[model samples]
Target: MKSDDVAKKLRRLQGQIAGIIKMYDEDRSCLEIIQQVAAARSALSSVGRDILTGEACKCASVKPGEDFDKILKSLLELT
Candidate 1:
């Protein structure tokens, strides 16, 4: 949840994306390419989950309500 941790995770995901690009350039097998795609997807999902959890915690700390749906809706509409 820290900036350093988030940066590290983003770097790892970037590396995975680069590897997928390299594999494509080298004409890697379909299975290998798919595997790399899956890995990248999993990494991105992990990062998203981390962000969501951290935000949820922060929101909960300031807002002492059990209306998660309302909170989430307001958060989503912010942008």
Candidate 2:
């Protein structure tokens, strides 16, 4: 995905975190809190996957002699 899409996802995750904190402060039900946390985690994982996919696509487009090993290493470390 594009940088703008990633930024939007990050902002949404940030809002989710804030909501989680508020729920905690309000002593919301454990189930509700857990559900929100799971949603946030899923969102973060999606973002990570998107980033890795984008990086991989970029690496694939490079010429044969280009240094993609670094990108490969970074993607592996991220996973």
Candidate 3:
């Protein structure tokens, strides 16, 4: 994904995080806080998936040759 896309997604996530924090300060119900936590986790997971996919795509464009094994190992390590 492009930097702009990543930035936009992160900005939205940041807002969500801020909202969660605000809720905590206000002593919101445990269920409400937990709901926010789940949403934040889901958002972060999506961003991570996008990042991994982008990295894989970039790596695929390279001529691997002898380094193919090393690249594969590194990619595996990432997961």
Candidate 4:
């Protein structure tokens, strides 16, 4: 994803976090709060996955026979 897209996602994640905090403060149903938390986590995971994939794709164009360690490191770091 582009940096702008990533920034937007992070901003949205911030909003979700703020909402979760507000719900907790208001003593909202635990299930509702948990659901929101899960949504936020999923969004974060998506952003992370996209960033890692983007990086991998960039390094993937290395010339044939070039060192493969960089690509391996990128995938390894993802885990």
- What C-alpha lDDT does candidate 1 achieve relative to the native structure? 0.80
Overall lDDT per candidate, in order of appearance: 0.80, 0.86, 0.82, 0.82
lDDT of 4 at 12: 93
lDDT value, residue 26 of candidate 3: 99
Q: Which stretches of candidate 1 lie over 4 Å from their true place?
A: 62-79
- TM per candidate comes to 0.75, 0.76, 0.75, 0.75
Error of 2 at 42 (Å): 0.6
lDDT of 4 by residue, 1-79 (tens): 6889888999999999999999999999999999999999989888887777667667776753446666656565764
Of the candidates shown, which would achieve the greatest lDDT relative to the real structure? Answer: 2
Q: How well does candidate 4 score on lDDT at residue 39? A: 98
Per the 3 Å backbone cut-off, how many clashing residue pairs does candidate 1 have?
A: 0
Ranking by lDDT: 2, 3, 4, 1
lDDT tens readout by residue for model 2, 1-79: 8999999999999999999999999999999999999999989988987888776877697753446757666675775
Each candidate structure's count of clashing pairs? 0, 0, 0, 0
Clashing pairs in 3: none
| Candidate 4 Cα outliers beyond 4 Å, as residue runs | 63-79
User: Model 4 residue 42 lDDT?
Assistant: 89
RMSD of each: 3.9, 4.1, 4.0, 3.7
Per-residue alpha-carbon lDDT of model 3 for 1-79, expressed as tens digits? 9978988999999999999999999999999999999999988888877777677667686675667657666765554
For model 3, the stretches where C-alpha displacement exceeds 4 angstroms are: 62-79
Considering every candidate listed, which one attains the maximal TM-score? 2
Worst lDDT 10-window in candidate 2:
63-72
